[model samples]
Target: MKTICGLDCCGACDRKEACGGCLKTNGRPFGGTCVAAEWMKKGGKDEFLRLKNNLIDEINSLGIENLQIADLNLLNGFYVNLEFTLPSGQSVKFLEDKNIYWGNQVEIPESDRCYGLVADDSFLLVCEYGCGGADPQIVMFQRRQAGTEIKKQNLV
Candidate 1:
């Protein structure tokens, strides 16, 4: 029996049977204290802007269909970031990133974790500047050095 746009985050949201998510309320989300909402207002938007630009730059440098980004799976008390993607039956996942977190439980391992992009090259990509507690960072090589420095974790 959840109200408030059915997302249960808003204290006074009354939009029944519908939720605008990040698009509604001017990218403000539904709740005032909502992590995603607060993040967008504070600095997440700017981070995303940078990531978009970086992704564009990466695409420009590596060609549109030459590279692929790896997927991430997160888990909290109640299955956060469930990797249940409806397969598109394609060879590559491309730039498809689904980040779903809420700051309740945050545990990111630096070396032992699934990579952000396809692990084919000698260099590993890391989101040097993470956007939010939930959003994925597209910026790579901000702190990590080039070459086969960090070992890749097999997320099979």
Candidate 2:
């Protein structure tokens, strides 16, 4: 029942339906739900393993170092947050988007952050980043079901 977020920390709260840690008046990101848990229930355990491996591979491919696993309480499934330092000496943050559609990207201008929630039929990963200015970049690595990978190419 370990759950985590891509922000290199445990989910806001231990509850699967709600998180108390990162409390934002606005509902959860994605689609007002927990995307990672949904995938776990749909694909089962084997798919989860594959999803994890794929994520690791993706991170390595990015040439990112200084990776850290965030704390995720296991309420429904294993949710985790991975924090890493990009080669460019920038920071990245990743999180789980709970929207029904896997392939969606959202940008927050106030924070200068871009988010990519990609999913295939079996897996879903939330790829987020902060660009421009002298702010450190952030990326999130969240695990979802297999074959549910979504790709968000552009962030407006």
Candidate 3:
């Protein structure tokens, strides 16, 4: 079992049997490109690390209380594709089910709930939810401004 980004995701993942692995599929695990692996393949580790660190800084700058993001790991889209109810009374999911993303889970200070942070090259999403992502509420959803590459500057 090999990994594109050197993370032991395949060993820890429950879907390994069905998904094979990132290395086996050339980063297209589960029929979707893994963001971390794709970035690593294109730019090597340093560039990917820079992108991850920059994204962390961008997420932290949002000023959401106690939502500091330390590190982001490769995450399956379906795992974080939480449904959010809009102010217009419509429930929606913002992420593609088969896509991969960089995300982190930050536990809100002194609370049982947690903040779920998910991002791609195009957007940043923050949501709050109870145990097991139950009763989720969208805290923030912002898209990257046009022509602003995530590696070059702030996301929004």
Every candidate's lDDT? 0.31, 0.40, 0.83
Instruction: For candidate 1, give the lDDT of residue 86.
Output: 28
TM-score of 2: 0.33
lDDT of 2: 0.40
Q: Which stretches of candidate 2 lie over 4 Å from their true place?
A: 1-31, 65-134, 138-156
> Per-candidate RMSD vs. true structure?
16.8, 13.1, 4.6
* TM-scores for all predictions: 0.22, 0.33, 0.88
* Reference-based lDDT, residue 94, model 3: 96
Q: Candidate 3 — which pairs collide?
A: none
Task: Evaluate model 3: give its lDDT.
Answer: 0.83
User: What stretches of model 3 exceed 4 Å from their correct place?
Assistant: 145-156
Regarding TM-score, does 1 or 2 come out ahead?
Answer: 2
* lDDT per residue as tens, model 1, 1-156: 332222334334354123344445443332322323333344445543443334434433543232333222211112222222224633322221222223121234552223233211122233211323233333443321243122223322
Task: Give the candidates in order of lDDT, highest first.
Answer: 3, 2, 1
